[model samples]
Target: MTTLNALHQLDLDHHIHPFTNLAGHQSRGPLLIDHGDGPFVVDAQDNRYFECVSGLWSAGLGFSEHRLADVAYAQMKRLPYYHSFTHKAHSPGIELAAKLVELTPETLNHVFYTNSGSEAVDTAVKMVWYVNNALGRRGKKTFLARRLGYHGSTVASGSLTGLARVHDDFDLPAIPVRHLTTPNYGKEARPNETEVEFTTRLGQEMQELISHEGAGTIAAFIGEPVMGAGGVLPPPVGYWTMVQRICKEHDILLVLDEVITGFGRMGRMFGLEYYGITPDILVLSKQLTSSYQSLGAVIVSDELHDVLVRQSAQHGSFGHGFTNTGHPVATAVALETLRIIETEDLVANAEARGAQLRAGLTLLEDHAAVLSSRGAGFLGAVELVPDGPAGAAGLKAFEIAHKHGLILRAVGDALVFCPPLISSEAQIDQMLAALRLVLDDCA
Candidate 1:
């Protein structure tokens, strides 16, 4: 039998963790999560922790959701696996696509499935290029992203992502892409500048970049309505509006990466609705199946969909798909996940709980080690005062919070929070209480 130490040794020898420093991981070891309940998880040693990060900003239905488990089992028994390729289709996949179309904005009516957000992003890039080629716009191949934006980690998607870590040493940005300024008013906006002024400046900056690159060469501008993994920064007012207008004027497509903010994280069915901005392509994952299963989708606009259809008719076929393009089991789980989100009204719950969380964190703005607090909906972050370097203080705070029975993430000094959508008012209070104790102890 595998003892705990044996399991640890096995992991240390074989496991290659993502987004981790390998040497440091070998030294520190892994946190073995044995089980979970509601919004909390228990380690192998029976240590319980409030899941403040919602399992990498997914798991909206929380841990131990039997509904999702049962659905998976039922689907497995009925039709465990099937492929949607060569004009073949399945009910779960077809129904899920229809449901997503119904839930999203009107123009976004077509859904293309992938197994993860990374693949969805890559697919969106390919679709943009394909549509441009179909329109005889061969020169429009460049992609515009923002300095801190995160799309995914695939070769092309990583190129679209603007974070340096996603690029460093990977020799990425393998494609022709340019990154613009992040619309983080708290960090980037100048002193005494109004929100309008900031928005205009960023818009002008984007326009300038477009002009520098020649608008004919740029294919699309991809961004997150609420930039996640980049410190949970919410867009400033008028940011998305100006960006959308710019895309229209330049004839560049607008691709919103909703991998982190989709499925009711932003107090709306979609983050685009929350900001009142539309997009040409919508990349989705993470919460689509509430992370119960691996599934993703790229929802395209009617205009682009028509172009792709024409392209396919002109050529022999579209020539793009995966082995599990719309795996029956994954889609079935996603269908049930959507039902739960809608039936439970978790979107509204996120709004209410987000308000409570923001209020509680705002009170910490005066703390000696806290720099500021900012968030929207159930997603939020508290920037810690840098002790010496940027991540130093935040790292300490994160360790303290863990000791206080909370699981939190520190992206540099900005500690991000994304609790499950099903969290009760009392659970939210408990999260805040844990944070308070950690802050006091650290202070």
Candidate 2:
């Protein structure tokens, strides 16, 4: 067995982790995660931590799932690898696509596979352009996104992401991508502005941008139903509905980035369903495979799909695919993962436990350090105010929570919590209790 120190050295010497401070991590050494059981993961020294972020908000079934292992192993034994190109197909891919079509919004009838969320978003961008081009609207090339909204990290997707940190030094926003204000009532709301008024104003802002840029120049407007990496800001009431209406009025394609909110994370299979809005294009990833495998998909409306098919036929081929676009092993695991979510009634569990979690965390609203507690289903965040000279109170709280046996992530001044969908009532209580203790200690 490799020693902890040896593993740390190896990681420091070679592995470059995403969203990490490389030099700081190299000096402090990485957290050597050894294994996981249920909702808990153990470090190299066997210290268990409640994985509140669910392994970067993807491990929907949590860790230590024997069924996923069995599915992956069986698929490996049968057929380890294959490509989905030139009409080639596999059983798992076909089945998963059918199930996804069934589960997604009624309008999203066709699915295009990708190896990751970034690839899926890139593909969606291409599809939108292709569709517009096919319809003879070549000037409708601009894409509109919301400020602080995150899509993915590939070239086109990264440009679509509105986070400054994601664009710094990258020379991004490369193409015709524009951003509207984030609909964060807590931070963006004006004094005396009600949630409904804020929603109206946000819609007006979108309309203003569209008018200024000329709606005919814009191809699509992309947004997350609930802004995830932008600090878990669920839209105020009537936000999505009005946005959808605006898009329809302007003939703009609406692309919902459901990377974080899809597959029952928001107590619905799709965020669009929860928000009661349908989109021309929908992007899905993260929990689709429950982190059991790396896979993502872009579900298109029938109209868009028809245009894409015609365009591709005219062009000879689509000219977009990854080597592992629909890897059999990943698809097999995803198929089984979806089955587990269905059979275990995990979506219902997420709804129930999410209520418990919200209730428990809301009790901390009076805590001097906590500014707000907001959540939808199992995804939530606690915004904090800076204490003392440093504006690192949220980061400090994150460290304190980790030391107290819960893994939490910080987005600016917010403590983000997205536990596994299978998290039990006791685990929810444990998570809150850990936070309470950490807050008390920090105070």
Candidate 3:
């Protein structure tokens, strides 16, 4: 056997892949990746596949950017690791923090580093409790998240996540986190309800929850600006505006989880910008380093930062930080990534290409198997209904597309596509062609 085959066999025997069926994977073996070039990743057998999901919706700059590699090399030569605890810091971390404050929503000014989105979300949850403790509101501890919202996979963050599979067999949701309705028009909207009325009803349901739970006892309301892992569902018109107003009126902290929607994924630098809402605390990851490295950030508003500072001074140090927090290599890579996004105008590109993607995917809506197509910028999903004995056609479409040199993801019965921001119009067309073939094959 070749080295690649040997490696795959070893991996199948030794590794436990995340979110995968272990026994099935053992039978099939892993798709051992050897290299990548410009939106395409090659397996050990030299078979190339278009990475439609952006390698878990994180590789916004694509896979073969030498600039990112150079940044990592330079940072590793200088300082590879560092902790951001007890006022200790490094140059790359400090500079990246400054850039984040400048680039994020104006209300957000403080940046807390974490190793991943899960850690960032867990940190946000702790901060909510800490802030309430500082303010002497001991009763404010419960958190409210939307039913389809995906925050992270850590204990607290996973509890905040509303996906059922993430909770099954994990004994998760260890904390008191309430889940509300997801605003998926196809799945949840009533026959007579307009999008506007649906949004209003959801907002009212939130208001009712606040009243029932006692506003004094609720700490924060966490949600993605556009539900990504829940199947890339964007909010209805005026949905976030109403949600923000309700949160403010109830004095509940609004925590926007932008792990998947941040860094130009939603045609803007942040989903909050797309939705026109100013959150008090924001969770960011994924596209921050563009999967070049593992890094996450919890951005706090000036108000929350002030409160945290005061509380820390009174009690002691903040007393929370990860060992790899503000890792120099990751920070340097992220800094260069952001610079590339700005210099290359990738955000604008995502907006333009996103329109083309949406337009192309919209054509699929006429297909008998397709139920709906929803997207914002490059992130999108096509919901499929059961056609014949295949059950969920979208899932079969995903597998078919994968075999046809395209890697797509299926969330429930929906096929999700989140291509890189650097993707060209031709690449978008190629993706659509592959998708069309898959859909036709499925039919």
Candidate 2 scores a C-alpha RMSD against the true structure in Å of 1.2
- In model 3, residue pairs whose N, Cα or C atoms come closer than 3 Å (at least 3 residues apart or on different chains), thus clashing, are none
Candidate 3, superposed: residue stretches over 4 Å from native: 388-391
Per-prediction TM-score to the true structure, in the order listed? 0.99, 0.98, 0.97
User: Scored by Cα lDDT, where does model 3 land?
Assistant: 0.89
**Model 1, 332-376: lDDT tens per residue?**
999999999999999999999999999999988988878899999
Highest lDDT against the true fold, candidate? 1
For model 2, which pairs clash? Answer: none
Q: For candidate 2, write residues 167-209 as lDDT tens digits.
A: 8998998878989889899889999999999999998898898
TM-score of 3: 0.97
Can you give the lDDT of residue 324 in candidate 2? 93
- Worst 10-residue lDDT window for candidate 2 reads 385-394
Full ranking by TM-score: 1, 2, 3
Instruction: Itemize residue pairs with steric clashes in candidate 1.
Output: none
Off by over 4 Å in 1: none
